[model samples]
Target: MKEVIATHSLDEVGKHPDFGSAQATLRWMLIYMVEETAGHVGDLDTRREVLDSEKG
Candidate 1:
């Protein structure tokens, strides 16, 4: 299900729907990409913080 959603989202990201202005389409794509990247960055920050806090 996750893969299916990702695939469908990528397909839409490429098309740039006709109803929206070019800048609006680009903005939407940029927001999605930033959000996806932020999720990964948050995960990495969490792991690093945990490692630093551990008594090793």
Candidate 2:
């Protein structure tokens, strides 16, 4: 999924000399994690709403 692609991109970037800095890697990893979590949360919320409506 998108996570796999993002993980691969992070791995690739971390290996490159230009983005090899520890700070940069950490920053990007944090941002990526946040974005991924947000997407998951949104999906979970949508499912929860659907389930709630069905239960009503």
Candidate 3:
């Protein structure tokens, strides 16, 4: 992926039919993924706290 990105330009991002403009679209996709992962992590932490409290 790094090599591919190195060879590709930001301008070439959304040129293909399925995905759209690469630069803008990929940026949003990455942001979404990060947010989603954070949410999952928060949920996991909450669950851990609850379980720990139950052990007290």
Which numbered prediction scores highest in lDDT against the true structure?
2
Winning model by TM-score: 3
User: Residue 48 of model 3: what lDDT?
Assistant: 87
The candidates, ranked best first by lDDT, are 2, 3, 1
Q: lDDT for model 3, please.
A: 0.66
List clashing residue pairs in candidate 2: none
Error of 1 at 34 (Å): 0.8
Q: Would you estimate the TM-scores of all the predictions?
A: 0.49, 0.52, 0.57
Q: Which residue segments of model 3 deviate by more than 4 Å? A: 1-24, 54-56
TM-score-superior candidate, 1 or 3 = 3
Model 3 steric clash total: 5
Candidate 1 at residue 10, lDDT? 42
Question: How far out, in Å, is residue 56 in model 3?
Answer: 15
lDDT, residue 41, model 1: 90
TM-score of 2: 0.52
The residue-by-residue lDDT of candidate 1 on 1-56, one tens digit each, is 45645556443534446755544344476677789999999888889889898532
| Candidate 3 residue-wise lDDT, 1-56, digit = tens | 56655676634444567765455655565567789999999888889889887532
The full ranking of all candidates by TM-score, starting with the best, is: 3, 2, 1
Summarize candidate 2's per-residue lDDT along 1-56 as a digit string, tens digits.
Answer: 56755566453434556665645454486688899999999888889889887531
